[model samples]
Target: MRRLMICSFLLVLAATANAAQPIRLGLNYPSTGNYKSEGLELRRGALLAIETLNRQGGVLGRPLELISRNTAAREEKARANIEKFAAEGATMAFGGATSEEAIAAGQRARELGLLFFPTLGYANAITGHDGQRYLFRETNSAWMSARVLGEYLSWHLPNRRYHYVSLDDNWGHSMEQALREATRSRDRARHGFSRISARGARHEEYLAALKKAASSDADVLVIVLLGQDLVQTMRLAHDLKLDQRMQIIVPNLTGSIVEQAGPQVMEHVIGTAAWTWRVPALVKSEQGQAFVDAYIAQHQRYPDSTAASAYAIVQQWAAAANRTGSLHSEKIIKALEDHRYSLLKDEQYWRSFDHQNVQSIYAVRVRSRSEIMQDRFKQDYFNIIHRMDGEAAAPNLDEWQEERGDELSLR
Candidate 1:
């Protein structure tokens, strides 16, 4: 009788301990698709953060475990993966490499009532309409980046005639609209916008269009396309002898683009971004250096925007979890609203209204390998293009309610 009672007590204690374990976090990303490289890097960064957090004794005294799923950059795959994650008891999910995939994932997440953190999808649909309760994007929206680029162009290159060659997708369209509005508000004649599909062999057609536009006296070329598309487009432009004819500006060019296009094609191309692998000494605070060093050590390579976003987001989640002492959605959300934690030295803090993290912008001009080797690089992108105040970045609740948000019935 005594042995039986002791065994039963031990079993109960083991069960209780198991039950008290920290909840698992689900990470959905494109692990086997066009953007698989970005996904792998992002996952590596996320794991680095998670490992660091756990080493520091984790949240609520229980170590965190990740439940990862791959989307393959396909809508059907993403939807299926989402369901799989949900069924596997994931409290939340984070994803969005491409615009279409991200939008679909966001809409589905909202429909399923899961808290989804978007890493690097620039589409506006995620947080555009009633994105308060479920969706939290630590990344800047397409509008945010577009507005910054517009303001910068207005100030610096006011005399130059700007022609836009943008990707014809949700992300590109939203960004184009924002850029168009901003440019038109300043001076309509200075800027013009055009569309191009990032996928397929539309390069010659687009190049011909660009050539015609240039012939009409367009001076500056602003390209809004993905890394792969940008590589192809730039190569085509270079072959056509069009690049040397115009000043090129690429807003969302990644390190991967440079790697793809090689040193030759990327030269003289200026880009705006949220983060980079090369951290300048002037901007390298202890925290920033630590994050950079940690990432490099873990991944055995330089960190890009995708990696930075994933790491930053995980840090954000950890901070929120630690502060709240609970992984529950409401508590974590409230903790994020406080914005008291320092996720990184980049000052990438979250906004309460829209739940978007307002981070600093960097303007980088592609340099030759020899120039890069000489370490003669400017740390700041464009001498502080725009310090987007979080308050200004905050979307109006009433305005959001009017635009499809009001109709969203999230029960």
Candidate 2:
């Protein structure tokens, strides 16, 4: 009887050991900072992807686990999260939507030799940094987005002069430089219109500066602020009645910004981003519709561009992991560069040269409460006019270098 019991115990132990899984993933982003709303959305979307992947079957026949860390909107916290992720045996790190955070996370990925997949922050440096492989941006950079926006402006409203309202920071300056270069040759280009500092909580000062712009001949107002700043500035603009006169333009600002600014302020507000699930092509696809449905069911609301963008990136990451057949960072990085499969909802190619996941940017307009009441706002918050191809939008090394040069000189 004792020998039989011992044999049974040994069999149970061996079975348990054989069934254990190995690969782990880490997600680093702000869950309680300036962009907490967006950051949380990113986490939720990524978590959804992780759950879905695990449900089907994890990578390389092992159940995958995810450890998420919050940046808390602090650089030290962001760095700490990176170290923790590495120390915790994470082979790859997923992060970003803000340029500063993306670069900081990428730097850590470089030092630790972990693959970092950036979702939101579109700083140009990720791809440029002398061909660094540690960082890979799943979405187009602010550099590419700005260039596309500029070209759209030139093509759609050729005769109109352009004006820029940029925050005094790396993000603002890089985006501004992209626009400047895009519109460099135009004689009517209204360059250097207004420079605002993004270093405050309350935005009365920004309101006053914008009020002055309202008085100017600048018909096209390009705002480069997101989240609270985007909401507050739009609120002040509406209070000051700037929307009735000028065409307001902002890039990569999501629908959550619209919701936060409230229906009154966000009405007639125009913005651009990679892809909103609200778009028709996205809504019709299986993955796109499923993502939207799941997000709405879980969060009880429509997801903004920030949420959609992060979700798209998470899906891309999972697909790459599954295809690579290994959780090793180097293998995953190479798989990302290879980019074997297409995201069910995406409509563009992932360029191998710079690891820029190329997709068309969508331009959107906010609907009024009146419109929503009339049931006219059920459609996507943004209307899609065209899809810009990657080849058409990507700049050569020389152009990228020139843009960076202009940026350094500005500082």
Per TM-score, the best of the predicted structures is 2
| Pairs with backbone N, CA or C atoms under 3 Å apart (clashes), candidate 2 | 97-120, 97-121, 364-382
Tens digits of per-residue lDDT for model 2, 99-213: 6777787778779988777766665666654335677676767667767676777777666555676766667776776666665623434543666765564576677768777
State the lDDT of candidate 1 residue by residue for 326-369, as single tens digits: 66777887787738444454455666666666666655577765
Clashes of 2: 3
TM-score of candidate 2 on Cα atoms, chains taken together: 0.86
Question: Highest lDDT: which candidate?
Answer: 1
Instruction: Give TM-scores for every candidate, taking all chains together and pairing residue i with residue i.
Output: 0.85, 0.86
lDDT of 2: 0.67
The runs of at least 3 residues in candidate 1 whose Cα sits more than 4 Å from the true structure, single-residue gaps closed, are 1-8, 15-23, 130-132, 185-193, 198-209, 278-284, 374-411
Q: How many backbone collisions does model 1 have? A: 1
